[model samples]
Target: MTIVLTFMPFAVGIMDNDLRQLLAQVARGDRTAFAKLYDVVSGRLFGIIGRILPRAELAEDALQETFMRIWQRASSYDETIASPMAWMATIARNQAIDLKRRSAERLAALASELDETLADESPDPESLAGQAGDLRRLGECMQGLPNERQQLVLLAYRQGFTREELAERFKRPVTTIKTLLRRSLIALKECLDGAR
Candidate 1:
């Protein structure tokens, strides 16, 4: 089967009535409407994923997952509560966050396995001393952040809390948590660079 996708001009202050209609049609299992909906909002959704995910390939993967979720969940979407774009953006954000959380969990698992394997391996005294100094430097840098930011950074990075989980624990929006993390990372980078 051949599919043709159509693109519609979208701009700020432009109502997404057409997009909303397309989504409604897609919910009825209309493949042509799905293709048109993809063409209409895929760029914006991809940009959202790209901003959230560090790697291009991961962002692309997240975008694909976002669309898959959109296709699966179209019938559950409520037009009264959110615009089509907002609903789509939420799906994209969620997919990106999920991908990041899964990646972190995999890395954490690998690190834990490595640590267990290396527990009996003793390092030279010089290497131990160097590691001690680095840990001290890191502690000093972390202390420079505000208490809330310090806690957020530790919970998010060191403890492997996802942004959504941090939002729930801190009673803040996920976007706020993301912003705090970005600022905290920038501050740490500057502090570490100056200490070097």
Candidate 2:
């Protein structure tokens, strides 16, 4: 059996206005609305995830896991808290952060592995496509950021460095690093239209 996917342009904007309406339907167990919602938001969600997690491969993994969580948690979205996109973005961001922490732990154990062991070299097409999508999105967001802020955010999140570590590298205080991260997030959220 073969699986096929299609790309559509700027369709998310058309559906975003109706997202709450569709999600309300989804909460009521409407399968059709769920399908429509998936079609509309998947790419936009990928874009958001790509910006938060710099590594294309890791971002792809996080994106899938994020959507899976969304599938299970759609009913939990409350309009009073925030918009649907912001709610969904929060879910994805949490998932990406969790994955980052886990990856750090996993990498810590790699010292025990012998260099003589062969590495897996098989190229996965799906992974490649997912990564390409992430890269495209990341490139756009990176371009949108001021050069300095971009570097700060990349150093902190993409490199998985602590604020203290970033501070040491930049010769700034840890409080400065934290402030930068907070400000960077606010700016990006504004650029991405208040996505959390």
Candidate 3:
């Protein structure tokens, strides 16, 4: 199989047995062996990740993750069951699928949250007035939030930034981003209720 990583391509010149030898060396904590394996396999892994994650940036990220996993889990490889390339490709595919699912979930959260608080489309004057008032209160509450938190919410909801992107931009962990969003929503709910 051919291996293409980002702009550069690496040929899979080594045979399957050679890959198994590299994996064994990697399992023994041979850094040089690991480096050799990476140079040989990264292009193929990137290709595998790209098939699952259409975005080039995400596929790049996934490729990095796949190597990290392979590096850590090389000792677990069973050549008797599957070839080394097959094993690594499986890791790349799973990592991309996980990234895709997580991004989708993060993107969906705020839209669903807003949908739950939104008024029905009955078009009644009184309901329209109440919806307008609630929307105004939301704007006010959002303004009351700290600038960073406000940016976080607006970026995630309005600009459609994913949790990973927010973490990178904010220089925080993904867990921290989730906690901040949850706390911000709680604060907004309290503010809205108190105003009512």
Candidate 3's TM-score:
0.54
TM-score of each: 0.55, 0.47, 0.54
Where is model 2 poorest over a 10-residue stretch in terms of lDDT?
110-119
Model 2 misplacement above 4 A = 1-17, 112-196
User: Candidate 1 lDDT, tens digit per residue, 99-131?
Assistant: 999977865675465346335666888799788
Candidate 3 residue-wise lDDT, 1-196, digit = tens: 9997776433345568789999999999999999999998898788888888877888999888888899899999998888888899899999999998987787578546755654345677767877888989999999999999999989976788888999999999776787687778889999999999
Evaluate model 3: give its lDDT: 0.85
Clashing pairs for model 1 are none
Candidate 1 global CA lDDT score: 0.85
lDDT of each: 0.85, 0.73, 0.85
Q: Give the TM-score of candidate 2.
A: 0.47
Off by over 4 Å in 3: 1-14, 114-196
User: Taking the tens digit of each residue's C-alpha lDDT, what string does model 2 give over 1-196?
Assistant: 9988877664456556699888878888888988887787778777877887777888999988987787778889887898888888888888888988887665544422311222356568868876775566666666777786788888866677776788898888665566566666656646555321
